[model samples]
Target: MNTRNEYIYEFGDFCVDAVNHLLLRRGRPVPLKPKAFDTLLILVKNRGRVIEKDELMELLWADTFVEEANLSQNIYELRKALGESAREPYYIENVPKRGYRFVGEVKESVVAKHADKVEEDSDKTIKSLAVLPFKPLITEERDEFLEIGIADTLITGLSGIGQIIVRPISAIRKYADSSQDPLAAGREMKVDAVLEGSIQKSGDRLRVNVRLLSVRDESTIWADKFDENFTDIFTLQDSISEKVAAALSLKLTSEGRLRLTKRHTENAEVHQLFLKCRYYWHKWTPESWQKSIEYGSQAVSLDPTHAPSYSWMGASYCTLGIFGIVSPKKAFTKAKELVEKALSLDPTLSEAHEVLGAIKLFYEWDLASVADSLKRAIELNPSNATARDLYALYLTAIGQTDAAVSEVKQALEVDPLSLIINTDVGYILYFARRYRQAAEQLQKTLELDPYFAHARYALSFVYLQEELFDEAIEEINKAVTFSGRDAASSAELGYAYAVAGRSSEARKVLSELEKQSKHGYVDPYHIALVYIGLDDKNHAFKWLDKAYSERSREVIYLKANPVCDPLRSDPRYADLLRRVGLP
Candidate 1:
């Protein structure tokens, strides 16, 4: 029998990580008994070669007086866990009168790693940090996302490292276009250090200057300047991450060390395309997500091995479903496949895990076991606002309103200016039935960007709950104007008109939705909202059943959504809630 080493083995759709002692199929854990797991591990080590039954039994039960039945049971359990039939095995094959052989193709997954990881003792060690945008030094038409995009990338790399809290881009993006000192900004964020840099692009040649500054005394602990072509961006990121880790006195496991240095794609152009997709992706708009899918597909086609691109692709589809841009059935199924592929490739990707969490909550609605993904994502990256927000939503769906609000508040502190995060605070408050607080929170978001449709639309919902028809109309109009008469916003206006006793105006809005459905995807959930407002329970239930068939994302909100107040007393309401698995 051969000895098993420290590496992950990938075969078919499953990954067995020897370092972490985990067996995951598409990022989800599959339980196995200790001996059963060890048995499978040994089989994978010697694939394509059959071991004698006596040697297999001796290796497995060297000390114990285990019978043949026990060995057979272990193999049976392993085959059942892997969904392999004994007769026509996908993984293990029985050689007649001999031991089982692993028939699946196996490859050891290698992540990037560095040889330099040292320890130090210092009072002002970086316990927390914020990676501010890399300033563009030479270009006049600097892409706004490019500035923050560099920071976001660094945040992803540094998140998996132990003992240092890295603030996400959402928390510090307000300073991206400003000229604030790194230490001062870090002081405001209450972090121990700040990483700031500048990028100068001259045709294909690129110059990057970066510094890690201690917030305590405003002194530079590490600083460097790199001159290379655009294609070497991955190497530059690796160097910066290593320097930051070394200066902070952080200890990284072999696997964690590999995470910071993994390359997404070798083609520089495809890498840049991925950055562009992420930039538009954070916008959280229907049109922007479509653009993300476009560029992300290009990147995937160019380099199929790029896990980051697949992670972002999953996120785009997840966002589209969550925001009601498309049907959750189609969108989330695609998202699930992409995210599972990403996790199967790189198990430590916090971003991919976060997308998986979203898919579980908003699409699967499988709340009982959904906490694992959300918690793991946040545990991997505490500064990740998106993961935190999704967890908050999950808590709310299960009637943990206070915990949900607390979680969102923490996320908001890390990303005060993010329109989506800010808007979500109001939405969460609304779910808690704190109408006044919800209104106040949403109003603040509108102050940051009145044109942001998400905030405007959420404010309208708050007004509707409070029965402020005039205010609701005003905010809904702003949303329609900003979103180009979007289906959700229009349907919301119809609800306002119906509840206000303006039947003609309500019918006019419904007519528009019907016409728009001919050209684009209109959520049946939106139509059901209008029927609910019209006080037509039969029609509302009809459309709602249609929504359930479509797996509409809005169905998750039925537990807390105030617009469904009229239907709350009906028997079907409880059954609907039950079917959605709400608390």
Candidate 2:
């Protein structure tokens, strides 16, 4: 009964969607009679200008002989739907002896419509796609877990398709806000199409409505609705993937078909827990990672055969170890055991292999096995951004700096919004000793998230290399504060102090780090960094030995980290490199 238009109007919390013939308040649809919506559209279109009652009735009814009362009734209904009393007249104001005027301040936005195409042009390929988070049926009450979970599942199902580039969850998470326009998101992501949807849950059942839209022409490529028990979510996912693939005319390979229909766990509850775990994991904070572990452990306990749960937990532990939130030995041991268990259960698990590869590269220092695992992980799922990111790190460790940069850049294409990925690109450039380029890259990363301590800490390294001591100290100092004075950030601050001739402050920071190591699992490598800065070669070598004996995570960066430049000419440095298996 409604025709689409390439325009939308926004005022306060309401969106007048001429394109959909719907009035949404705070992202939830409000029921309005067809005639009432038509009247509202006209008033909003001609806001701040009054039309006489005769003109308003004639425009709405055309040749039909409609009474003035009918037009007045529509206005009354519009006012009620807008939550305004006629007397208060916030949105609709009646001019004496004239038609009503829309008083609300409106912001108009035009949806760009691509050039018209004939039926032959319908064969245009849908190469890249984005699945945005679903909106809830109720605006005031949200089920964020379910909303993100469904989109994430669909993303995973389609990611293995080589013919299509499906944007990862990290890149699409920002669209979780229901207010986001799907086409706008698609344009920003530079994707061919977008899958936008809404979900409603009642008791043990769900009602979902989804439509795949073309970003080029705003055409509906495919649309569907599902009503089923919540436990049947797997079937919903399979149906959606099949329909989308068919709509796009993708001739799926056997592997892609299998991937689309694969079920990691039959138990719906365990699936929900796994989704919650991943949701928190992407938050990329110490507290969030801990929460991720808790949820992942719960999922694993509930369904031990859920390989993804184990792998995700392992990944969380790996991150904790790298950030010094957990001791290296304890964290790596737990992470390795978990991922190994995951591999034993599901040998083809891409992320499980990724986690194993990271453990081999960073903890065991088994360079021989690292490449195989990472390559296998990527071969299984080319869209696994984390695998590519870790592979970049491995390449950097092996002195393949150019390959490492390429790999990280590829990872960015998959998850352009990932804070860690952005930071890693700059870090990889830093390790390559391209100080100016690294500084530029890190500054861009800071623009993405100014308070991201990791980016600031990395930018500090770039500043230090450029001999910008004051800037380096300021950056690391902010990094320390932003990271809640984490040991890694504090150690970097100490290094900046020493390099800038603030030996007393550097020693103060070193003293605190030593105190921390006495009680907790502080990486001695951090202490060594300060020693190297202080030009205390003997003490630096002493701590580096301890680091090697302990297999500190930071040891992998020895071949490239500029902070160790002072000791590079020493025979001990060569011996350490030989012992660590770095050529």
What ranges in model 2 sit over 4 Å off? 1-123, 486-489
lDDT score, candidate 2, position 393: 94
Model 1 global lDDT (CA atoms, 0 to 1): 0.80
Which segments of model 1 are wrong by more than 4 Å? 1-126, 141-149, 171-192, 202-205, 214-221, 486-489
Query: How well is each residue in 219-318 modelled by candidate 2, as lDDT tens digits?
Result: 9989999998888989988888888888878767666698877898899999999999999988888899899999998998898899889988999999
Residue range 1-583, candidate 1, lDDT tens digits = 2333357899988998765456778865565645678889899988899988788989987875545655775788688789987886999999888888999999887543222211222354566788998887855756666677778778877876534568876577767765677777887777878999988877877788989888888888889998887778777778888888887776666656876676766788887888888887876678888899888889888988778888888999998887777778889999999999889887877889899988888888888767779767765666677887887788777766666787687777656666888998999999889999999999999888889888988998888888889999888888888878664448888989999888788878777876776788778888888889899899899888888888888888888777888898999998999988896
Worst 10 residues of 2 by lDDT: 113-122
Q: Model 1 Cα displacement at 384 (Å)?
A: 1.8
- Best-fitting candidate, scored by lDDT: 2
Q: Root-mean-square deviation of each candidate, in angstroms?
A: 12.8, 21.9
Each candidate structure's TM-score, on Cα atoms with residue i matched to residue i, is: 0.74, 0.77
